[model samples]
Target: MQNQKTIITVTGYKGGVGKSTTAVHLGTFFGSRFRTLLVDADPNRTAVSWSKRGSLPFQVADERQAFKLINEAELVIIDTPARPDSDDLKELAKGCDLLILPTKPDIVSLEPMLEMVKDLGDANYRTLLTVVPPYPSKEGETLQKELSEGGIPVFKTMVRRTVGFERAAMAGVSVRDVDNRFKSAWDDYVSLGNEILELLNK
Candidate 1:
């Protein structure tokens, strides 16, 4: 690992937004290329359980052990719980190279995400639109426009809502091991990882 370690925190105010899934898959993807550590900061321990059940090669750290892993790993991905406030977000935002907020296209999910963006108060962090439908829908387009006008940086590639993701999760496998239908999802995640790398390089 020649590059300096980069920290990425995945947060959202609402549950079922695919935060843990993103953390697991992204960690596995990057771990293949870099010495990555996945930190399960959420009290729920969903990521920790998933990794144990999936039997992944990556390591998981609790709050107490996270700093040590952060100091040692080439990359750290922190998976946070839902509904974290400004102060909480700030604490996690410190030393982070990138902050990824995953949200669905519906209004219920978008409102809190907007509040999170305001809380972050930094323009460099990236917002990822997750659980999007396969085809372009009216709601997805509208939400995309709202985010863009608000000056939030959102990735053009989106993760579609599919059973493949759920199935992979249950089996403790990543999208990388899933079928071809999810190839685009894997690519989108890789692209986001690449974007984070680019930002860190800058």
Candidate 2:
């Protein structure tokens, strides 16, 4: 393994915003090219359960095993729990190379994400819009504008809402493992993954 390890933390202020989903797929993306590990840092152990149930291509471990694996893999993606306290945020920010805040377009997710960043202070982080409408909608565009105007760093690619994710979850597989019916959804994550890789290279 290389001495340079990249720690990517996928976290959010609220739950069900696709944090685990992002962590899983992003780990898959990186695992394709580099040695990658996904850590179930969330007490819910969603990633660990998903990996056990699904045919994930990468390694998944509980939070307890994260430290040892981080040193071994080229990239480590962490699926964090919702609404971590200030101290936890500080700790995460201190340790991670990149912080990914996955959120939906609605206010239920938006408002808390804004507040959550305040706790992070100056973390190297960016917001990823998830569960967006597939078709063009004013809400998604407006939310992007608002986040931009508020000086929030956001990803250009948005993960649209699709039943494919639900199907993949039920089958214990990733969107990539699902059939062609979920191509669009899978492509969305691919685009997002590419964008993240670009950022990492920079």
Candidate 3:
């Protein structure tokens, strides 16, 4: 496809922050418009397992295949191992067009993400808030404001926690493609995908 090549690396200090899931859905978003590859660089192989369960719209490759497949796709999303050391994060920041650090709103996720941000040191990155509890709770907004005020780059879109993601995972499909009940969850990612595109264009 004519889509500009963009390598996006998704990583965080903790698992279960939806890092792989974000990579998968972003792959889906870009793949639908341009050729895309999702690389399972995580030892847990969450993306591999998820793709194996059912057909994903895009290609899923183990880290070993990344070098070969990366050139063949217009968009590449790498799901990295959790807790990459400062050196690795620095190198990773220099390599990818965008380094996405997914963080949940809870303290458990917040602390490590904060530490990871500190280690990044001027990396071309943005913090993506994930697994946000549904309304009536302002945790996501609160944290986003805090981080932004602190001069950290944070995405405007937040991925809300939903069982639809679990359902989509079981079926190995993009959240929006899986069911209508989880439209909001999918919408969140759609917004994120758009924001990413806009950011890249800038």
Candidate 4:
């Protein structure tokens, strides 16, 4: 059965593709507009750690704590363990309102996401290209075009590589709360959050 609450699951075949970061930012985005809850299911407990460091507008809990907190939440974002096998991938796809696959702009990151989509069946999902190299290099856009031409559903927003995210994490806040140099980085996610809202509404 589909979940009544709007749920998004972040996962990928490769690790360190910013899965937890995506989950955290997405949570903060929706949290301001709704009662959001971020569930940390990853073994690393990255999201859990982030919550402890700073003050977030929304509440965060581990997988176990999520059960009690979920019903009260209007939006729920799950940060799953990375490198899920095919079976787990299918299950994760089936369980959410949307499945987000975060990957860097490269063959290695792209390949796993491509493989996962092959098995999505009818799942509502989108690929987010992140940590894209900044200007003077169109690598991010180039990769996005190639993926779209190849028929993958990709978000228009590409998160540029920046250290602002790290500082925000250390301070337990969203990218917007960080340094001015990271403005573009935070804007990337703001654009991403808008795209997501549009997709779900449609």
- C-alpha displacement of 148 in model 1, angstroms? 1.4
Q: Write the per-residue lDDT of candidate 4 for residues 44-162, one digit (tens) a residue.
A: 99999998998877889999988899888888899999989889998998889899999999888888888888998778988999888899899999999988998888899988998
Best-to-worst order by lDDT is: 3, 4, 2, 1
lDDT of 2 by residue, 1-202 (tens): 2568888998888888999989988987778878899989789988888877868888899878877776778888888888888788889888889999999999899899888888876678999999998775767777888888988988888888988888887777888888998898889888988898788773
- Where does model 3 exceed 4 Å of error? 1-4
Tell me the number of clashing residue pairs for each predicted model.
0, 1, 0, 0
- Between candidates 1 and 3, the TM-score winner: 3
In model 2, the worst 10-residue window by lDDT is: 134-143
**What is the descending TM-score order?**
3, 4, 2, 1
> Which residue segments of model 2 deviate by more than 4 Å?
1-3
What tens digits encode model 1's per-residue C-alpha lDDT throughout 101-198? Answer: 89998878888888888877763577788888767566666677778887888766566777777877777778777789778777777877777666
> Which candidate number would show the highest lDDT if scored against the true structure?
3
Model 1 alpha-carbon drift over 4 Å, by segment? 1-3, 136-138
In order, the Cα lDDT scores of the candidates are: 0.79, 0.85, 0.90, 0.88
Clash pairs, model 4 backbone? none
